[model samples]
Target: MSPGGKSAKSSSPSPPANYSAAGEEFIGVDDFNEDAHTPESKTGSAYLEIHSRQNNAILKKNQEESIETINYLEIQSFELLNT
Candidate 1:
């Protein structure tokens, strides 16, 4: 170390400073597409085909269960004298 102590060197580049204002048109929310944010699945066709079949089966099972539950509720509601 030198008797007069100072940092040897700096190697970082300085960033440029700039700011500007510009005018542009603004549109209402009605113009926006709802699907813009949801990215489409990129899975290949074969994988999607297998997944679709599995999902269809699961959906049918769930739908059947839902209808059964609804039927039970409807019967229970019919038995209730007080609203």
Candidate 2:
């Protein structure tokens, strides 16, 4: 028995050394043909795309608003200094 009552033979493998050099194997036609026309899958993908676009637009708008606020503050500061 090893530490914590676990045997040495039950140890997991270490991370691959040359990970970048490995190539992924694609599944064959039989696996690919499965779920060729899934309505739920199509709907989910469309929803994801729309949600992603909306979130991106909201983020851009917030960034633009922040820049405008910063510019307004700078202009006010300049005006105050000139007075």
Candidate 3:
């Protein structure tokens, strides 16, 4: 028996390969309506922005704290060496 359980000379038709391309256009808030005012929508948008800002601040604080800890360790090592 061959590797595929058939003779090596057995001919089999191969299927054609397929390909596709797709994309989408993003629409901003200003593109939707002229006067469809709603308080909830505005509040939600503002809340998201505030949340993003807070997250960025927390990340920055953590990074600064890490640097400070590393500096403190270096100073203590230097003091130990002098003694």
Candidate 4:
């Protein structure tokens, strides 16, 4: 450390307040592209294929369970209202 109370290391220039990693500036509404954020098929195929049946079944089961839970809650609420 220098006796002058300042570090001797060279400092890099700081980015501007509006600087963004996405680009030079933050994305604006006019610059927003809905399709740009959508996933693209690197394989050049339009269809997405799931190679794992076990994973697919697990996801499906979870979805079905969620739907069943929602339905049960709705029924309970209805029954309470009728009471």
Q: Put the candidates in TM-score order, highest first.
A: 2, 1, 3, 4
Cα lDDT tens digits, model 4, 1-83, are 88899878767665443443344753332233333322232331222234356679999999999999999999999999999
- Tens-digit lDDT string for candidate 1 (1-83): 34579665656543222211122322332232333311122333344567789999999999999999999998899889555
Mark the regions of model 4 whose C-alpha exceeds 4 Å error after superposition. 1-51
- What tens-digit string does per-residue lDDT give for candidate 2 at 1-83? 88999776945564333221133332232222234322235554565578789999999999999999999999999999999
lDDT of 3: 0.59
Which of the numbered candidates is closest to the native, going by highest lDDT?
2
All candidates: TM-score: 0.44, 0.47, 0.42, 0.37
TM-score between model 4 and native: 0.37
**What is the per-residue lDDT of model 3 for residues 1-83, given as tens digits with 9 covering 90 to 100?**
77988777646543222211122322343432224322235654675578789999999999999999999999999999999
The per-residue C-alpha lDDT of model 1 at residue 55 equals 100
Tell me how candidate 4 scores on lDDT.
Answer: 0.56
Residue 16 accuracy (lDDT) in model 3: 20
Per-residue lDDT value at 75 in model 4: 100
Candidate models: Cα lDDT each:
0.52, 0.60, 0.59, 0.56
Which candidate leads the pack in TM-score? 2
The TM-score, computed over Cα atoms with residue i paired to residue i, of candidate 2 is 0.47
